[model samples]
Target: MGGMNKIDEPTIERARRGDHRAFAAIYHAFAALVFSVALRISRVWHDAEEITQEVFVNLFRKFSQFGFQSSLKTWLYRIAVNTAINARRSHLREDARRLVYEKTAILREAGPDPAARLQAEEEANALLDLLPQEQRVCIVLRTIEGLSYQEIAEVLEININTVRSRLKRGRETLLAWKQGEPK
Candidate 1:
């Protein structure tokens, strides 16, 4: 809703009232944002695509429940975040199962050390992995997604102070870890 004009009101109303055409238009406008957020959360392209589709399907199913209190963009972001979180949880569970069952079996030959091939960008991203997931998500939303603290609070349904603290802690930890790393 940051830059959205009043022109979107009618489309939002129609979509809320179960108009497929209006909903499709809404989808067109926000699908990329939804997918991008999902991708950033899940860190998996396929999971992001699935989460995006699920978010739209959920929107259509619950559109009537929308009270227009929040912008459609914010609503979509909430859905995307929830979907991505669930998908990530499921993915981790599957990974745990694979690790337990495949511990004794070798599916493929071991590869060389991946760290040896790290590029500058990959090394930068590696710093992100040092933070906990919640802190990482806050940093991603604030810095990478360019959302304000209040905007992140709205989308995340948390207090603004929580967002500020997470960002502060995340930045401090990232810096500390980077400094502790060998050049």
Candidate 2:
């Protein structure tokens, strides 16, 4: 459908019928992305790996419950984020948090001024630093990941309006933090 391995609707339907190949197709399609998101949330690579494995294992175990309410990918991402959050909360590994530098994040293309670029990146990172994990994930999914509000709701298993509220709150927190600083 999309690439060579895109799982078509029919295939997904069959996978819902307990087709092994279809299950594998779903897993292969989403594993890397799930891992990446988990890694970002977890910060520690090993925790991310554990969470990814747990999410997939849960997916396969509960595969039968997957109705066509949302795309399979969205469901899996929800499970991923939830599992990672739960794990982080349970462990309270607050010290392991990582800052996301926008420059290192956007190094794909060359920019005009390296110094100004560095400052912007640092400032963006600093702004993000003030938010909690829930707020950060909402912002990251909405802005950095380009997920629509509905899609984010499905992926986070939140009400669509709740997603909007969190995004708003997160944005407000960021804005206040920014405005509180000197220009």
Name the candidate that leads on TM-score: 1
Q: Kindly list the per-residue Cα lDDT of model 2 for residues 16-129, writing each as its tens digit.
A: 788889878888888877886776566556677789899988987888898878777777778988998887676565544444333454455587877787676566556655
- List the pairs of residues colliding in candidate 1: none
Listed in order, each prediction's TM-score against the native is 0.79, 0.71
| Runs with alpha carbons beyond 4 Å of true place in candidate 1 | 1-7, 96-125, 181-183
Number of clashes found in candidate 2: 0
List the RMSD of every prediction in angstroms.
Answer: 7.5, 5.1
Regions of model 2 farther than 4 Å from truth: 1-6, 93-129, 179-183
Give the winner by lDDT: 1
